[model samples]
Target chain A: MTAPNASPVQSRPLWGAGKTVVLLVGAAILWSYLGTGSNLLLPFQADGRHQVALFFSQLFPPNLSASLLTRALRGSLETLAVSIMGTLLAVLIGFPLGALSAYTVMGNRRFSEAEGSSAVARLWRRLIYDGSTLLLNFLRSVPELFWALIFIVAVGLGPFPGVLALGFHTGGVLGKLYSESLEALDSRPLEALQATGASTLKVFLFGMVPLALPQLLSYTLYRWEVNIRTAAVLGVVGAGGLGQDILVAMGLLHYQDLATFLIATLAIVIAVDFLSTFLRLRLIPS
Target chain B: MAPSIEIENLVKVFDGRVAALDSLSLQVEEGEKVALIGPSGAGKTTLFRLLNCILTPTRGTLRLQGCDVTRLSEKSLRELRARIGTIYQQHNLVPQLRVAHNVLAGKLGRLSTARALWNFWDPRPDGDVVRALTQVGIAGKYWERTAALSGGQQQRVAVARALVQNPDILLADEPVSSVDPALAQEIVSLLADLAQEGGKTLVVSLHSVELALAHFPRIVGLRGGKLYFDLPPDQITAELLSGLFTRCEAERGVPERVLRGAVSPVFPLDSPYDKA
Candidate 1:
């Protein structure tokens, strides 16, 4: 049992795909740097430092006037509502689509053929899978800001449009995450149930659903955190939230008011992040 | 009555090249108890899967009761599958779910999709789940998390799942492999007696030749996806047993315990069939 090539590891070439990837990544970074005309020292130059100091000076002494404080509070509430409602809508739209798009959720034709499923049943499964996958692709491809613009035109300007924008965009994101997690679920339990003569639907409901749920919930909570950030800025397109107030302050040169809204945005994002992280830990422990 | 299981020159090829089962033929009479013994990769599990109708053969014919499974309609195949139960070595229960729900999962074939989904959230008290748990001596852990149970107890839960299915045929694929030897003997005896009392045809694959001979009336030895010997326990000699496990131990992936078991096939003749 003596090895013919005891030092096989050392003999083998180490500079292959790993080095190629590092070279490609390095090239991409260099290309981006030149393409964007990025200047690393720009912020450290004298004029650059003065500009930065002026910006910071304006950012302080936030408007703590009672009226503006009340407005900020209202804006925060609106942003929170948009995120929660948007996420709820996303789940309603994404869950079914995600389930359909998952590779393992729909029984494959070979198994179905063995079971003697009709041609029509097979076609129906194919259609749902392909259709949902394409739909999710289209939904997520467009940015939330773009969706907000379209939604604002259709529904007129309000938080409702922002909710719709976030819903449509995040639905695609959550749908993809949901499908991947579902696809990655351990197939053993599902196969075992299928062996018991359970219908595909029965197996899915009992086996796949239970196995994938914790991961799905974890993904959804994570997506909700992302949606909060998007919702805050969705008002740039007149979709109404803390973002609209911040934009108005920026346009009017109300730096103090802008500072208050920025603080409010950060506070809300941090709050939502903490809440979702808590929920994920409590609901889906590793 | 027609044989409960019939396989005529069944061949199952994996990935177009690896023949998991090659031209293997076997028959089990109604209510007969059979144990399959072999090295790892001997196609014992593959044969069980084919019998369970979860895996279709690449060639040859397979019949359950009297119906050819290959020709059964989707609905008919499901109906046929409902009449068979399987217990795996890993006991594939959904760990996040309650034990009672996992047990009731055995009845998914009979339950409507809506009802099955509802049962997960609201597992209404079912006598069969309770009875199966009681039969396997784990009734107290019905509402407990499945993952919370010990390995041996989890195996019992798997047996409970198969039992709750109330099928006419039971396939146990190395169901007791993970447990200690004493618990393995207990589970094997439990499976044999349950099948006997219910008059269901039982087929189990075993790693230990001693357990197979001690519990089952008929022994089937598989090697390299082919049958080496099929004989009553008393008729199986040490030479034939060794041929199945030792000749190609390294190449065939025969585990050490199997070779060890082959060395000492002697066991007390306490098989229920002996009483008969």
Candidate 2:
């Protein structure tokens, strides 16, 4: 049993990439386990954790109150309308313009003509793309609440401002998404199309559109989901929807009312999620 | 028909450093199946590009079917390109589209924009697409996607596309390089047939000297962006080939077998590329 001078059977050395990957995964899980949105200190979480427990307990006495449920249901409908309108507008307006912006579709001539070949032209294309990106950042950055606050000032407190805010930001985000999709396409078809005496828009409409449709649909659906979330928070700034009703209930110390709002919001979100998933899957090619 | 092509004092420089084509002048009469043979860096593709107006010349004039190619605009170039069919080594068929669509793309330039876009009403090359496919021996596989076809079949589709165009002049850039010897011979024969019918001029750049000698009546040799030989294929001696291949070695007369016929030693297999 006298083995040669080999360091005792070190249990597979714990050294290669698989071990590294497992260790990284374990570290991530451990970090997620320890962290909540707030600090690890006990004081701030105690009250919130208690509220969650109380809310769970109230499930038996689940807010079966009829009139309150009806109002929450109505608020959910408003949220749906805001999301649909915003997404439709984004898809309708952004698709064609996005195709025009792509180098794959437009070629060096159209691009160089619109911009140029020099550093100035490169800077120009970049500046235009960046301007749109900045606009998207501005729209998505303010977190819907601030937009609703600003809109509520001018439009005087309603779901109209919430819808407007959603439309504005979603349009910007979708436009950028669509333009990038156009850029990533195979250029050969567009070149073939353009070389056939087709105009830029015609090439986009015929050649690029059908090819890019799946990407466009997926991005639009994603934006719709985002808009639904944004619509819920609009009430925080008095832009309207379920948020407004929830805000009032919270102000009145209506814990049971809060429960009803949360349940309705959850139901609406789940429904939208299911519908969007089905649509995106259907729109995607096999 | 007038001469299929006429190039006079054609000069093109890319980035002003590389002389892609230097004062290159050439002409091909109707129904002439001319083969251009050259080594790497000999400016074969550059000449094709300039002839088709895909790239403008830095200096000189080009005339196709007696019209000044140098004077054409982008739109006119598209029309000119339709008249002059080009086949690349890669067969350049849009892989995503169906073979039918790619082949019928022959009508893309000839038809109105709306007709081409809608495509439903475009009967421009309706029966011609099928006929061309039949000629290329892939008539049965028209509806399939282009990628589904083999390399030989894809190249046949490229030829079918050009045939559907019903072009007056055919320009092929190493059309057989992607296929095997048997298929290469068949393709060369097909080009020869196109030229024979109604005097269509077929100009092809070939990598094989044997194929060129057997299939082409006229051969143009290029060396370092300059024309070295423009003579009858019957007169294409091994000495001339060696000169084209190497200026120093060519001064001595070549061996008899080479002068008679040289079997291209590249691949062992000979004849039809694989079946469609």
Tell me the native contact fraction for each prediction: 0.62, 0.07
Deviation of model 2 at B245, angstroms: 5.1
Compose the digit string of candidate 2's lDDT tens values, residues B63-132: 8888786565555666766677777666356675678877766667687667766663453435887899
> Looking at model 2, what is the TM-score of chain A?
0.73
TM-score to true structure, per model? 0.91, 0.71
Quality class of the docking in candidate 1, CAPRI style: acceptable
Evaluated on CA atoms against the true complex, candidate 1 attains a DockQ of 0.36
Provide the fnat value for model 1, as a fraction from 0 to 1. 0.62
> In candidate 1, which residue ranges exceed 4 Å CA deviation?
A1-27, A107-113, B249-276
TM-score of chain B of 1: 0.88
Candidate 2 chain A: 10-residue stretch with minimal lDDT: A108-117
Write candidate 1's Cα lDDT for A1-286 as tens digits. 7598686466668688989999999999999999999999999999999999999899889999999999999999999999999999999888888989986776464232256777788788889899999999999999999999998889999899999998998999899988888777665576678788998778777777888889899878988999999999897779899999999999999999999999999999999999998888889857
